[model samples]
Target: MASVQKISTCLWFDTEALEAAQFYTAIFKKASIGRITRYGKEGFEYHQKPEGSVMTVEFTLDGTPFLALNGGSIFKFSEAISFIIHCSDQDEVDYFWEKLTEEGDPAAQQCGWLKDKYGVSWQVIPVEMVDLLNDPDNEKSQKVMAAMLPMKKIDLATLKEVYVRG
Candidate 1:
């Protein structure tokens, strides 16, 4: 079936399209793998992928459509592009952080951002953080920012408390 979403994210992997799809589907509660296409001899000159090798795998993560392309290792994921997961509460933030941070790069983590094993970066954030950071009171906003800046994974409850006390 065709994806109804007008725009979708495409992840480039070095012969890990299928593997990545499976990995992601297992993590997300509302996830599924869809169409998987294989390469053909037509593009052998450019892609150089075997005719029967996986070309792309389409999958969905919590309702968001994605495509995992079996692109070569010529391009690697960078921190410049990252996905933000908007969580509802501290539990959600902690859960996602623990799961995604497994085998992720420790040096890449900062301000609730983490890099997965595949070098893909993600921000597991509590929605309340956004609201508190953007609060009308500059003092509260500054306090929230200060409390969040040092945390690799945000402590939402503490941030809220900081906002209130400020």
Candidate 2:
């Protein structure tokens, strides 16, 4: 029997579906490409893409199922939607920030959010930040929020320092 994924996110790309899948799988642990579907002749009238070109790339990143579609350039990614990576510590945050932003636009980076080379937005944040932000003490949350606003990549230590000092 063929099992079905309960839900999966489909990422739209102009033609970097395969490339983006490979890039994401390489960066994340327990990630790998699953299947590659190419366009067929029958769809030429609508899709307009050459037959045999990549249509979709199915992949998993850290157990999260995703599909990268080589749709045309009619749409682009925006900061309105972003995937958040909760890191256990500073090192994890740094690693993801460095890798995701390696070829990404520096100007688009702000408040721990960055648009990767493929134009996908991601938020690399420390796991501790969640707890701090949700802390019942409004002062602590405000302090952490203040500390986080001015940074591109999150600084776990600095956030902790602010939370503790407050």
Give per-residue lDDT, candidate 1, residue 32: 100
Q: On residues 45-80, what C-alpha lDDT tens digit does candidate 1 reach at each position?
A: 999999999999999999999999998989999999
RMSD of each: 1.4, 1.0
Query: In terms of TM-score, how similar is model 2 to the real structure?
Result: 0.96
Overall lDDT per candidate, in order of appearance: 0.93, 0.93
By TM-score, who's the top model here?
2
**Residue pairs that clash (backbone atoms under 3 angstroms), model 2:** none
**Worst-scoring 10-residue span by lDDT in model 2:** 1-10
**Superposition error at 17 for model 1 (Å):** 1.2
TM-score of each: 0.94, 0.96
